[model samples]
Target: MMHNFNSDPFYLTRSHEFDWNGNESAGNGIQHVDSADITSLFSMHNGIKASNASGSLQFGGSLGQFEKWDDPIVADHTSNHNEKLVKLAQNREAARKSRMRKKAYVKELEMSQKRLLQLDQALEKARHQAAKQRHSIGRDDAFDRAHARWLGEHERLMDELRSSLLSGEGDDTTVHLLVDAAISHYGDLHGIKSKGAGSDMFHILSGTWTTPAERLLMWLGGFRSSDLLKVVEKQMQNLSLSEEQLVCIFNLQKSCQQAEDALSQGMEALQHSLTLTLSSSSLARPSSGDVVDYASHMATAMSNVHTIQSFLNQADLLRLHTLQQLQRILSPCQAARALLAINDYKARLRALSSLWLARPKE
Candidate 1:
């Protein structure tokens, strides 16, 4: 009962090479192990040996040979990665469009702000201009009323003078009344002009409220004193004026002319000084806060304007005084005749003005 050993079937086991621990590295294709890792390696090696005992292992001829197998987890991970790339591209495109829309909105907002600012500036300027025009119109209307009142009173006085003259050389009793009434009316008119002088000096001085014909004869809101003297002298020419009366007339005319020359020179000097002050500097451009001293210049200009207004008031006073002196120099009959001539001149000028205003225009 003997058995043959060579005829029995046998299994070949796979083996792995181990490497001992060194300073840094284990060479390729070797299991690297330190003294601490040796215990775990023995258990792992036993598991692999037991698994090999239960199954047959197939090996290719080459050491680098690899088997190709399809796994569900690997295929799913590839599909998910492709989907992520598509999602990332879409997100980038959406972000680009959002940035473009935001930029356009910002640009439009800037343009709208600029337009709104420009509109606001134009509206403010128009409002300012309208306010100034309204003030000018108000001044003109008030002056017009005053003139109407004076004309009505003056017409009554003229009628009285005519009646007295018709009664043969006029009465000495009414002469006092005539002279007093005339001087009082003129003083009232002068006072009205002076009241408006501070705010509307240029308009009052220019006599813009008067009719065009009256404006031609106007000097500081009334007729020039020298011109009045001329009227008086002409009226007295056919009268029996004495030597003393003639001398008084000559002296009055001389003084009025001298006063006018002095005021005129003062006005010219003021205008020259203001012109030089404005023209010599480079402040023509608008001020930027404290960069330019606009307040001081404004004060200086206002002072000059006030001085000019004072001169105009003085001229008005002189004209009133001259009329009073002329009335005093003449007798009642002679003074009444002079008043009549002056009224006639004024009536002729008004008639001329009416015609001029009604003339046709293109």
Candidate 2:
């Protein structure tokens, strides 16, 4: 019968001698294995064992167990993997830094844009102010030029009027009436009226007293008392003086003296006020307020001039009335002498006025 060792438990007992390399014999009728065959068998067993361990540890394993599979090739693969991870981390960091720099640059650009916008606005504002200032200056200059031209024209007209008066081209009576009418028109325009007869006389003297000293000297030269006295004496020889006439002459002299006194006082006051205003340092390049004040002063001076002119007209009327009265009272010879005296006085006055006007203002 054939031996059934596969089924016999005692056949493969632990005490039985066996040789894995087939270099030794078992205590049975087994054939001896060749050394080369034994080598092949051992190689097959190792290959099977390695395959089993690798398969078992495939999904999950400890670091030590994984390291057991380490060889030159495996080590090189790990090194390549680590290098790739390092490069990826470096790339991530570089990207992050780049993003940060980009953000900063964008912010800087935004700030620059805002700054440029502000500068543009500020420049525009400055330009506007400069333009406004230039416009204001232009207007002021134009007004000043116009005012100067008006003043020149006014002075020329005054000179012409003075020349006509000295030339005796017009009758004194007609001139006096015209002056009165002009003064009334002026008063109406300005809404000014005489407060009283005394004030009217005061205004007249004040206006005349303010005239430049040179003009006053020229006016004084016109009145020759010596010629007037000669004419008066001749008239007296022909006609006796009445009580009413003598009283009238005395009253006229008293009025004239009073007018002179008022004139002197008004001049003193006006000069003082003018000196204070003109000498002030602040008036040099007068401001708007200063200009207005100066204009007011000029208006006042002109009003005074008008008042004096009105008074002179009235005085002329009075003189004509007085002459008429004398003619009514005197004989024909006395009336003729009185007329001659009046003519001579008028001629002398005209000559004096001409001489005075010809003299330059000092």
Pick the TM-score winner.
1
What digit string (tens of lDDT, one per residue) describes model 2 on residues 1-362? Answer: 97576564323323335464435454655454455655665766675577667653221212122224657898899999999999999999999999999999999999999987866565555445433543453233333333345435534433444444557675555444433333333333222212222334443233221123323432221222223334565566445767775565455445544554554466566656656656655556566468876666566665655555454444433333444444445443344445445545444543454434344459
Instruction: Please give the CA lDDT of all the candidate structures.
Output: 0.73, 0.48
Query: Per-residue lDDT for 1-362 in model 1, tens only?
Result: 55433453322223343333214343344333444455555655675566567553223222222233357899899999999999999999999999999999999999999987866666455445443543576575566567668778989988877887787655687766876787788888788778767657888887766667888988766788898778767877765799998998899899999998898799899888777656644445436564456656666777887888998999889988888888888887777777777778877776666555544457
Which whole-number lDDT from 0 to 100 does residue 135 have in model 1?
56
Candidate 1 least-lDDT 10 residues: 57-66
- For each candidate, give its TM-score against the true structure: 0.58, 0.29
Reference-based TM-score, model 1 = 0.58
Q: lDDT of candidate 2 vs native?
A: 0.48
